[model samples]
Target: MSAATNRGGAAIGRISDLNPVEAGAVLYLRLWSDGAPGRAEMARDFAIALGADGGRSALAILDQIFGLCALHGRRPLIRHGSGCVCLGADENCFAQMIAAAAEGEHDDALMMALLIVRPDLAPALVALSEQFGLMLRRMAGRCAAPAVVH
Candidate 1:
């Protein structure tokens, strides 16, 4: 995916840009929501990427994020269906918010918390999103690695 560089030359892009981590996160969410084909394989890959402890932690964080959303009566904005290859604007915004929050951007974190109508939960949400994002990055790295056969 092509990315625009910031003043510091760090690449920045929307989720539609499909950076590996964002792509993996979107794929994971899609598989999770659909409970369809490739779910098991993707889960296995995620587990392998994070190892046992990290896998468990990531699962817990994900559960908490979902639970919070449920409790707040807010559904996450996922625009694309399971079969679709295109990422929609809502999905891009959602992923971008999470990425910014994970990076400790207070305005983004506040915006997300407000979007969920849970300003009280901002810190918790930010922390969870940060951990989840890190896990996704690790998974992306593992997926990108070339296989070595002895």
Candidate 2:
């Protein structure tokens, strides 16, 4: 039972048993909903994680997050002082964005999302991209640094 196929009892209830990508979707959803202080950063991290580790399963999970959110009539949120501001997007739009980006194996949805969340968070998102890219290169057994001369 691989993590991708393990969409049984636990995944329906909690994210603890999910694969890293699925679990990251859970984190993204949680932060997007909670409107917590650091939600932007956490959500961006998860978004990059999704794109960095792209696969059918990972993309499916990412799409499903937005799909379920749409089904449940949930909206992306951000905290503004004591109040909350909606990202002013429709649920279908959210689903479509995730679907499109996932298809391209990119993070456009998240990039737009973080921007909609807060303009100030752009630098952090860029940094996360570079960091995750390096991590992905290492995971693929490629050296991020220049090759050594014999």
Q: Which candidate is the best by TM-score?
A: 1
Q: Write the per-residue lDDT of candidate 2 for residues 28-60, one digit (tens) a residue.
A: 444555555445555445445434444333334
Lowest-sum lDDT 10-residue window in model 2: 78-87
Give the alpha-carbon lDDT of every model. Answer: 0.62, 0.37
Predicted candidate 1 versus true structure: per-residue lDDT over 56-118, tens digit per residue = 677677678656755762444444565676775445554655666656675875675566546
Q: For candidate 1, what's the RMSD?
A: 8.4
Q: Please report the TM-score between candidate 2 and the true structure.
A: 0.27
The TM-score of predicted model 1 comes to: 0.70
List of clashing residue pairs for candidate 1: none
